[model samples]
Target: MGRWEPDARGRLLRAALELFAEHGYEATTTAQIADRAGLTKTTLFRLFADKREIVFQGQGELLALVTRGVDEALNDASAWDRMVNGVLVLSGAHAHEHRTTGRILDPILARSPELNERAVFKRSAITSALEGSLIGHGIDRWQAGALADLGIRAYYSGYDLWVAVDDSSTLADHVLAQITVLRGAAAQALEAAAPQPHPAGVRSADG
Candidate 1:
């Protein structure tokens, strides 16, 4: 068996996880992770260009899943429900479910001056991808854009709170309830904006 080389990628992932959890992200090293994985540094480099890349591979899959969910929502769900569901799906479920990988990436990125500068740019990439998916949902362009922004903000706010509180409430449960509130607010706003009807005789299509 190749031992270190047979499953280099799996070894890298496990090594990175253990090292990250034990020594924290920034303190951990690619060489150390490679060593722990029973591989050479060159093999590690061949498998992964940099340490940060290891933490981010999952995001590509998740973003794809989110896009698929958004696209599927176009056919059947109400505009509001689709947007809401998209929001919920993007956030994922537990801290471990959607957050651990990002969480690991976040602190590492934050502490590095170079990575910090690029963080917003990376986030914008995801936001744009999501915006495209929202537009594909048959929502008006402006409303879809606003819904995407608002949904992410609300979903993340709830997500962060849930994480901070350490409560039993699931992320899905929390986000679904929040969607009802957002729907209510959006409905109220639309209702308030509807033109008031004139008395029957006073009404005219245009004149």
Candidate 2:
């Protein structure tokens, strides 16, 4: 069961997202957010630098969860397939934990340029972390980075599509279907490239 008592931080983020969805970003103020969260304005600032940061506090955790799953699982034949498939397996594996994440992330990205920029940056970081994981598994730096970003964006696109569709479609199925599409693309892209035999040459990646 979920905790009955309020979690100040969670409440803050949820309130911010709710308000962002209801009133739009520019019009939502710290005081309004505090009122929504049942927190004082000072406490909101104590937890976040400003209103913008409120939308992004768990971003590192998101990247870490995705990257960690990919780093530990490389059974797929090609690094590209692994990256594309990671879009599903890693993200789906954590759907429960990230359930509220999309609710918060989507609206903020939709309405605020600043939040959209932050989302882009977060996507870049996820891409970089995923690329580093691929590089550790013997893929070339530039190729790994490009494909990682591609896979993440593909997942993002699929996720939005899923949301726009009926709620009957689960996020996992949506991402998984997109992962399949991405994997098909990766397989076609790598068909002509000669396989490298040097995972040993790569450096370790952070979790």
State which candidate has the highest TM-score: 2
Steric clashes per prediction = 0, 0
Give the local distance difference test score of model 2. 0.75
Model 1: runs farther than 4 Å from truth? 1-14, 17-28, 74-76, 93-110, 115-119, 177-207
Query: What 10-residue stretch in candidate 2 is worst by lDDT?
Result: 89-98
- Residue-level lDDT of model 2, residues 1-207, one tens digit each, is 132346878888888888888888999999999888888898888889999988778777767766766665656558766776566655665454355567556766876788888778877887887888788788899888877877887778777776565455666677767767876887788885866555776755531
Candidate 2: which pairs clash? none
Q: For residues 70-160, what per-residue lDDT tens digits would candidate 1 score against the true structure? A: 7767477876667666666766634554444545545655556655655565556556666778787667888777776667656656665
RMSD (CA, angstroms), candidate 2 = 10.2
Query: Per-candidate TM vs. native?
Result: 0.66, 0.74
Q: Distance from true position, residue 66, model 2, in Å? A: 1.6
